[model samples]
Target: MTDALLVLNAGSSSVKFALYEAAQPGEPPLLAGQIERIGDDPRLATGGTSEPFGQSTDGHAALIGGLLAAIGDLAPGDVRIVGAGHRVVHGGARFDAPVPIGDAVIAELEALTPLAPQHQPHNLAGIAAVAAAYPDIPQVAAFDTAFHRSQSEIAERYALPRGYAEQGMIAYGFHGLSYASIAPRLPALLGPEARRVVVAHLGHGCSMAALLDGRSVATTMGFTALEGLPMGTRSGSIDPGLVLHLLSERGMDVDAVHRLLYDESGLLGLSGISGDMRDLLASDAPEARFAVDYFVDRCARAVGSLAVSLGGLDALVFTGGIGENAGEIREAVGARHAWLAIPPPLAIATDEEGVIAEATARLV
Candidate 1:
């Protein structure tokens, strides 16, 4: 019998999970899978196991049920779920690293909803589902904003006043779990003092972080998730004045502005078709090319600025969906940073699921 550690990463429309044979810290997972479009007919895919689980419209609870059913199919007695880990997007300044979830922790996460309304609700939903599914198993919270919590106050703080800053209005760099997964490896990828590293995590969402000795010295995202690089449908780094103009001049309310920034911009807004990179790349529409070019240009600029922040760049690491799969985006970002001498740009497939399994195993 092997102890299995289950990990759930719930996004806006889907939930992904990995079931690994629980081992010591830093070990890899045994099997992994994900279910996209959970509420509607979900798309289920597995890593080690090849047979695809077909359409089911049971939502997150069904997804969990499907996973449990799948595990049962593979010698239920051998696969013991020791613990579960979840990826929560924003922790504000409350969590500096991964922590065990509790009633107080749930309260703390609930309080930060205003900081990450798009993700926090779904994150809590997945967490709540897990709590209900496996009430006895110990669950852990792995904050995407946690690793960057090591960033200096000056780096995280905005130029705004103190009251809002006290109310958690600051830059809490995201993709911390992904960043942390590749951090220690940077030294091996570069050198022991690999002091200056700029990592761009481009996926459904995107952000750039300037790391000095594995700790976040600066990052592109600020105060909210919408402040960084343009993503699948997110409008990044828009002027604050535009927000006011939208509210006052364009008859847009707070919720309307939020949707525009969080759901209707980026590639979808530019291409006027799809938010997915693959779809845009495959399309013949001029808007598709325009959207792709715009994404690359902005990301290149962010890397240059982040590289400047680190004095110079030692290594440029790419992770996440776009970074790992889209060779074109990486090449574009790489071409921009070619001035850096020796050790050509490196792109590593980030293992957030693996990282979660490892972290959860240690605490369990």
Candidate 2:
């Protein structure tokens, strides 16, 4: 039996997992797959094929069982999973690095749920499911906010009162895992000139980070993931006063405002067509074109802003779904930044699971 490390990134509707040989740290996963559309119509997407997955009464628990069964079928004999690593979003100020999973650590992460409502619960659920499945296996929680802890105090702070800043209201950036995966590869890709870089992780949930000498100096995302570039469904970085106005004059409750911003906005709200960038790019509708333009505009503006933070831009790196796949978006954003006179933007595929596997290996 081969010893392996299991890495899991659980979202609201899916659990993305990969298994890597613990002994081989930076290698590709032995098996990688996602259990997507969990509640409504669950399916296992692996090896470029989608197959129906039977639902069970226990939610993530049952889903995890099916995942283990699939993993069993892939190898010759029993593949022993030595360790598990989870992508826990919003580590807050408490955790600046990956920590071994324990009851106390889970409780601390649970308290951070309010900061990342859309992600935290599902992340915790995945951990719980894994714990139940492999109770004896050592597990580690690799946080998305951990890498951003290298950022300066001023860059992470809000304009709010000193008291609020002291009480953990600082800008804890997300997408650190993706950025971490990209950082080490920059030296090989850009050589000595890889000092200052801007990485735009444009996906369903989008954000950008300004890296100075491969460490986060500033980022577009703030206290919440919603404070950055307009995403697939999120209304990133809206005026705070507008939220208050909705609560007072627009006859909208807190939950209503939350739903509108988190679920009904972004490309879908702008185009009135679809949230997926591929859908918008393909459509002939004026609204779709406008949405695409708006996204590009914001991305360009973010690059300029992050470039200022990095003193100047050396290179701009793109990762995540839209970044790696959507060439049109990249061309448009790069066109807007022509005056910067930097090297051509590079599209790099992020290895978040690989980063998790390595972290878990070091910890265990």
Most accurate candidate by TM-score: 2
**Tens digits of lDDT, candidate 1, 215-320:** 8888998777888888888898988999999999999999999889888998889999988888898999999999999999999899889887789987788888
**Per-candidate local distance difference test:** 0.81, 0.89
lDDT of 2 by residue, 162-254 (tens): 999999999999999999999988999999776999999998789999998889999999898789999988999999999999999999999
The C-alpha local distance difference test score for the whole of candidate 2 amounts to: 0.89
By summed lDDT, the worst window of 10 consecutive residues in model 1 runs over: 48-57
Separately for all candidates shown, the number of backbone clashes (residues 3 or more apart, or on different chains) is: 0, 0
Specify the highest-lDDT model's number: 2
Clashing pairs in 1: none
Return model 2's CA RMSD, one decimal. Answer: 2.1
In candidate 2, stretches whose alpha carbon ends up further than 4 angstroms from where it belongs are: 12-14, 37-42, 54-65, 75-77
